[model samples]
Target: MAEVGDDVYREDPTARRLEERVAEITGKEAALFVPSGTMGNQIALLCHTQRGDEVVVGEGAHCAYYESGAGAAWSGVQFEVAGRGGLFTAAELEAVIKAPAYYMPRTRVVALENTHNRAGGVVFPEDEVHAIAQVARAHGLAMHLDGARLWNASVATGRAVAALAAPFDTVSVCFSKGLGAPVGSALCGSAETIAAALRFRKMLGGGMRQIGVLAAAALYALDHHVERLFEDHAAAKVIAAALRDVAGAWVPAPETNLVMVDTPGIPAARFVEAAERRGVRVSAFGPHRTRICTHLDLPREEVLRVAEVLVEALREANAEASAGMGAGTSAGTVG
Candidate 1:
């Protein structure tokens, strides 16, 4: 049985052990376990920012597009996108930094997403991260990383998780994503920052009683799942290869576990529905784009079968588009 104690009082041994393990892996002074990646990120925002401060982010960052605007509602901060794509260069970050003025919202933090979602899970290059960190340090701005899929990055690039996380003042890593833990994320940073984050986590109603059961899962994932992520990455590439020949589909070679598809002239919903009809599921990333992710549950033996179904789905969507039956409908939003 998992060890249980009052986590609200900071006595949960399993959570403490998980936090210590994550902190050691991330090379941070301390770490705090939270119920979700969203809460961990929001707590980081609250710790790094004051009300009305601005946080610069890459376009389509999870914090900006997917977090239900918690950064604004809870942290009282607004986001300024740094670049057009989901990854930006240091110069791009520099250009977005607000000039000092009493009338302008001060630029207080730069938030980055490594293995960026919605951009085909591309890893943020380590060199660019260091350059961006230098710029942030020069400007007296703090750095935060949404390293939810960092294990993927580490596996893909042959870099240690600590190396990837080193440039950031605080990093939030999720156990529920590639790691396949049922629920949990941890925010790692200096002891002072995490101490403050503990208060914000409670303020945001994230305090839990005995969460060792969840912590145990995260710990297990850290031990057994990290190295196996390469399997997911490989499967994504295989699926992407199979989908590349589908009509009207632009499938990029996946860098990690996510495969993003752009369906020109066909509604992404049409593709999604077609795939669903074939007992396969994928998300409509936008009106003309779809996102497919490979994870622990998607075994190697199933990758080709899934890819074939998705290809058929794309072909059906293409046929519908050709018949002028896929017009003026929304693909809807997916976080």
Candidate 2:
């Protein structure tokens, strides 16, 4: 029923229903579906700012490092990255915001990530989110939440998704991630903002036909998959604990479904390569950290396997590093 008609004409019943459901979940006036989270975020920036406008973001935010400069390339805007770990204090936000002088690009938007990915899936405190929102409201700047993992945050914090979304002018959530949908994301905002976003999505060639198939999967995930995230969170913490004190690499107990291990002497990329050879998939975040993320598809045995793989990889990296140091010292003495 959803894909039977066209969405560009607002005639796809399933897509329309999915949009309405997302809006209600996020407590927004309206919603628009897009192909990917990147598109959803880029559309938000495009709708919120004009050419030369500045957007403030976190130093390790997806919009900053992962989006390939889409904010500047497509929105014709520049970005100012705030503090590390994807959280900035109200004062920090205020400090980065520029006065509307002719010489400076006007700061039109502030984007935040909840369950910040690069920060090892740290959840932003609710009060802290409100404080940042107050600053943005005070300065007449718009707020956007890169809430791709907000479902995980909601489950981890035991907070309603609407409460998490309350402070933002726009919030984008992903279905393709832990939600287990094949492909889709939605941008929720006021009716006016979504209307502007609709045009921007089309402008970016994001409008799709028969999106209802994907929306159906997302809807199912919302109903069935959300409550189960606690399982992933628990498993991730277990994995982190298991890999603790392995080769000088320390895994912080997971806050959500992501576990980050701190490698002291070895780089995360090298560890990732070594772990991959052992049949584990992990991503290198910053120079010193490697991250393991748990989702619906990752099984208990797989999580255990990944933990073992990480331990062995760290041992290999440590041995290699010690050997390199020994060789360097021997060469120096020989010289």
Candidate 3:
């Protein structure tokens, strides 16, 4: 095991190296290594906005719905939801930007997600990001990217991460989510922004002593794991196609390594349980929806196996529901 070094004082070589590499990749002036994606995002928000300010975010974004309202709880900032299903047009953003005369909370930042999770891993088109960035600039709002799956988007679109990050004031990238790193996230931004965020990070109890061991894994992933993302995306597509043909289910075309499937007639929990029984693990996001994610450790063959398990699971659930309906019909007749 690697020795723990005090990271709070900036003496951790591994953390420092990871931060530098993140800044280089994103073409930012500086970077800070954080413990998790949520912390990176919250710290970035804290750096950019005053208390009581608001951020414009997609309704389905991870920060808005998944981060447990930490932005408001920690920073006293609220969200102005932009659109449904994580899709927001530049015009929609323009309309939502707050005017100075209004007593409403000022929209200090526009936050976006790449490979939006709730949107079936949809890649927010590069042109769209640029357009939204332009809108943010026009309104003097800071732009932040919840780029947890940015590497997936970059691989799918063949766009450089730096080019994609250019329009935003800050971006948070995760190494653990899909990159196979055990733990780590990087927040990249201008020197001033990172300096400001570091203070907030310490305040939030994110200061570490020595994190080079984790940083080492992140460094390894950035160099060797990035290109392999295409394999994950391809596997997700295969899984989605397989699920689409299953009874009582519909899977959208995958844009990255996430596939969202709807079990129209079967309860989501039942579907998940069935899949788990067959040795495939997935998450139920809603009453009728499940999400499957592909990652570095998941091999292509395993992905196919998951698909097979999913198909069988759906079939089993549908059959059970049909049998129950038949039982109810017979009972009614007997009654």
Best by lDDT: 1
Candidate ranking (TM-score, best to worst): 1, 3, 2
Which residue pairs in model 1 clash with each other? none
Report lDDT (Cα) of residue 268, candidate 1: 89
| Candidate 2 positional error at 193, Å | 1.0
Worst 10 residues of 3 by lDDT: 326-335
Q: What is the C-alpha lDDT of each candidate?
A: 0.92, 0.84, 0.85
User: After superposing candidate 3, which stretches have Cα over 4 Å from the reference?
Assistant: 1-5, 325-335
The sequence of per-residue lDDT tens digits that candidate 1 reaches over residues 1-335 is 89999999999999999999999999999999999988988999999999999999999999989888888999899999988779998999989898999999999999999989978799998999999999999999999999999999999999999999999999999999999999999999999999999998999899999999999999999999999999999999999999998878898889999999998788988988889899988888888988998999998899889988988889988998899893645454543
**How close to the true structure is residue 66 of candidate 2, measured as C-alpha lDDT?**
82
RMSD (Cα, Å) of candidate 3? 5.7
RMSD of each: 1.1, 5.5, 5.7
lDDT, candidate 2, 162-260, per-residue tens = 999999999999987878888899999999999999998888998777777777888888889888888899889878888886867887778998888
Q: lDDT tens string, model 3, 79-186?
A: 898867897989999888888866888889999999788888899988888899888998899999999999988899999999888999999999988788888899
Q: Per-candidate TM vs. native?
A: 0.98, 0.93, 0.94
- Kindly indicate the candidate among 1 and 3 with the higher lDDT: 1
